[model samples]
Target: MSRDHQASSQHDGTAGDVVVLSQGDHTLVILYGDVDVRVSEELEHAGRFSIDAARRTVMDVRHVTMMDSVGVSFVVRLAAGLRSAGTELELQGPSRRVAELITLVGAGELARWLPELPLEADVSAEQA
Candidate 1:
């Protein structure tokens, strides 16, 4: 079974949303747009939900247009939290820029990188 939790924000009609989808022992966090300080709160909330729901969490970063220090912190912190709980974090479909920044910050070791997105069929099935 799967469940979804979503948080969205819009500033001056520009921003993105955080959507959490949990399936079995895996949870997928979908993030879009500028993932800077603006979405930190939503990201944190999603992180908490991920920890509470799954043993493995995957953050979907393919739709992110930009990232700032706060975004990096969120990933690092979330990874730490999950680690303490004996869970794991994975970065799914991160763009080159996002990947670079995370590596530059030395947070790359906190998570494993996946070049592909979660299965569309699974998402669609959950939606139905």
Candidate 2:
């Protein structure tokens, strides 16, 4: 992704912890929530919104607890779109499960781009 494209996204109103969307000088993040079939939709919605707003975008999924095909496709296609436009697309915030899924799917083994989850997030640590 472009060095200038940096953003963090937080998704609200879900069983998982709040997902974050923070914009850097030039990056977009698509955080992953708890296990859900609708994850793909959520991820795509966030990404399109960011692109529509005319911001350089990157997708972060390092925090994802579990990812299925839907979630996978959303990110893969999103990255393709950015590449076509010469824009940088980053996928960050992947959980351990997500990391394994990436390999299982053979999605180019994108290990270098994964980012760390927020220190405050409680993926499985149980919330108060």
Candidate 3:
């Protein structure tokens, strides 16, 4: 049987993100902007909410402008946490500079997890 349902969204009215859960073989989480300590809590909630439910999770970071070490730390920790539960986490779409920060922190090992994606406003289709 095929099942189709409308997706729901909750906005925090900050520079957080438009989280979308593409429920199929894998899940994709698209982040729109700065992911620093300020928005970590919300981002984590959205990311974990998706990753925890799927076998593979793709984190789309194409639109990320500024990502502090705190953000990086949270993401690395999230990856580690997900691994413990037998789930895979993938980070994608970081600008070259942002990617450098992630690499400088020695979290580059997670580089392979970043997926290549078209640069665009994915928010429009997030609910799909």
Candidate 4:
């Protein structure tokens, strides 16, 4: 596994974080807090890294408290790009609100939605 690449953004007194971890052919993208316009740059960077480095990408959104149009667009773009490259994109544990926004924007088909993220212990074991 490679060292993590992380970015954060804040807006309207709210904040968000984007962390990308590359593990051989897999990339884990952990997203949390408010995902909005403020974090678009970081999201873009993370997406590029994922596409370039991995055949499979898992986005963990379980900790996300909010998401807006920018966040949805990021997911859409990442999904489309990865699909074109024959890569897999998994959206793990999106909240109902986030899921609704994605569906509302016609992005539901872009990526596979999961009920939960992969086990942290499994990933940690691999690291060890």
Best by lDDT: 4
For candidate 3, list the clashing residue pairs, or say none. Answer: none
Candidate 4 lDDT over 7-117, as tens digits, reads 654323347888888777688998878998878899999999888874789998877889988999999999998888888789888888988998899888888887764
Point out where model 4 deviates above 4 Å: 9-14, 117-128
Structural similarity to truth (TM-score) of each candidate = 0.82, 0.60, 0.71, 0.81
- Compose the digit string of candidate 1's lDDT tens values, residues 17-67: 677888776988887888888788898899888887647998988878788
Go through the candidates in order and give the C-alpha RMSD of each one to the true structure.
4.6, 6.5, 5.6, 4.8
After best superposition, candidate 2 residue 38: deviation in angstroms? 2.5
Whole-model lDDT values for every prediction: 0.83, 0.54, 0.65, 0.84
Sort every candidate by TM-score, greatest first.
1, 4, 3, 2
lDDT of 3 by residue, 52-114 (tens): 664676677777777887678866876676677677677786789878888888776753555
- The best candidate by TM-score is 1
lDDT over C-alpha atoms for residue 31 of model 1? 79
Q: What TM-score quantifies how close candidate 1 is to the native fold?
A: 0.82
Q: After superposition, how far is residue 27 of candidate 3 from its true place, in Å?
A: 2.2
Model 2 per-residue lDDT tens digits across residues 1-128: 33232223444534333232545555555454663554545555555655554545655665556666776665566665666655656556566677667667766443236446554557556565
Give me the displacement of residue 66 in model 3, in angstroms. 0.5
> Whole-model lDDT, candidate 3?
0.65
Candidate 4 vs. true structure, TM-score: 0.81
